[model samples]
Target: MKRRQTPSNGTMFLLLGFSDLSLAAQTSLFVFFLLSYLFAVIGNGLIMLVVTFSPRLNSPMYFFLTVLSFTEILSISSTAPKALQGFLKAGRTISLIGCATQFSVFIAAVNCESSILTVMAYDRYMAICQPLRYTSVMTVSVCWKLTMIAWIFAFGNAVIGFSVLFNLPFCESILIAHFFCDVLPVMSLACGNTFFLEVFQLIMSVTLIMSTFTLIICSYVRILTSIFLLPSAESRHKAFSTCGSHLVSVIIFFGSAMFVHFHLGNPLSPYNDRMVALSYCVIIPTINPLIYSLKNNEMKEAIWKLTLKIVALHM
Candidate 1:
């Protein structure tokens, strides 16, 4: 493939992903990422399967877990394939429409993931603090509605943000200094005034992230209060254990995201930005299933039973 040295508006944008590194380094990263991407896909896929088919895991919590796993798969998949391709070849170009679509999907998936996490926290809150009302509140219909609302809001936000960004003229070079077409990098290439757009993006990002994170924090505070008030040590331990996986997941995801979005400085260099984004975008999703499964006894048992059933079928 020919390398594009110069790109402009209405043309393709060349992704310069880790091209500054040595060939050996790029190859190693390629291999590592390929394996990680596959593992993430398969791990999240397994989570969805177990949560869906295992009747033993029929609570609203598990239903939310299925939604999370699906969103994780979508989130990682948006960039992993293109990133892997970039590692193999130079001039990994994406058309304007293609880049816009990828960014849109990525934004939607990420926001959806945050929304689902917040909902999961609320689910836990209801189960622990309002156990008497949990069944009546978090019915199957309610769960489905919550999931739909998350997706709808996510895509709606993504469409609006990207539509404004893409409508701007681009007269500068179109070399994206990252693996994928991220908002900041793509915005850097636009010719017209982007201050308004940047402000708009910042507002939107903060609103989505901060709102969900605040709700999750509030839910956990109430949950922890209830757990502490429990009279029995065994019951308190059980309650804490139930929320352990989700707490860890929330920390890992939001920690990296906050660093990237709210750091006190100029924008991160391409290398640093890629490293930070790679953690939540790929690594977190890959290990999320393990976090939930290992922490939750019910999930572990369901997975074991499913594995046995699968092996028996093969035999």
Candidate 2:
């Protein structure tokens, strides 16, 4: 397939998303993505609402969980719509500005998710390892400050990265191989040298991902050590259980994120990349409410209470 070289000022870029696939496959993906997108939005939105209103959930952990749910909503919203459109139609076109905006929002959301997860890990560490000082260390004001920092860092990185990436001359081709304006796919379309941009992206990816991952790992290590030191096995199990949901979330998110960002030369194929991206963007957000809520007794209890209250009101 040949593409005509378009000027950098080209307003629209064709997203060649799954056009090569059979109609049946595309239609199947359309249905699947539509359902997944809806589930992700509603599930994450519900988690946020429950955590915000439930008096029993008024803790630093739940506060951070609310932030995480909000981030997941943003993450799914950024890519799932474009992806669904591409699956529904052969070639979906997105304006350059629109593409840039999507990329910025998605990147910010990803960054924020990682940062918030790290904060949650720290909260767990404080609770488990320093139980007496947990309240003092993770107070409401401090939690708000930390959450604000995450938001500021995410948006700052997104704005800087977007400005650099979009300024590049994309005279080679306008057809983004993937559904969304991902960094690599758009970078591949650049006509001139992208060495600086590539390095910048690498730096950003490594810094945001690995830094948060390391912090989480360190927090978990301390938490585990503290759990082991507990006198009774029951207490140890109880302490470990509290961190279980968060640990699972971290693993799922970072596993896919690392695979996508850390690899050279498309880790398998373009389709595989899309699948992995889909997992983190759509699957993760959709399943996060389940991971945090189903595995968590408090979350389940809160949901049950909230549901009953709604039922009574409706009755």
Winner by lDDT = 1
Tens digit of lDDT per residue, candidate 1, span 158-192?
99978787877776577899998888988888775
Least accurate 10 contiguous residues by lDDT in model 2:
1-10
Question: What's model 1's TM-score?
Answer: 0.95
**Whole-model lDDT values for every prediction:** 0.87, 0.87
- Any idea how many clashes model 1 has? 0
Q: How well is each residue in 1-315 modelled by candidate 2, as lDDT tens digits?
A: 334354444478888877888889888888888998899898889898888779999999999999999999999899988887876564498988889989999999989999999999999999998999988889899999999999999999999988888877666467788889998888888876777778778877888889899999999989899899999999998998899999999999999988887874334587877777788878999999889988788999999999999999999
Task: List the candidate 2 regions with Cα displacement exceeding 4 Å.
Answer: 1-10, 265-267
| Candidate 1 residue spans exceeding 4 A from truth | 1-10
Question: After aligning candidate 2 to the native by TM-score, how far in Å is the CA of 46 from where it should be?
Answer: 1.0
Provide backbone clash counts, one per model. 0, 0
RMSD of 1: 3.3
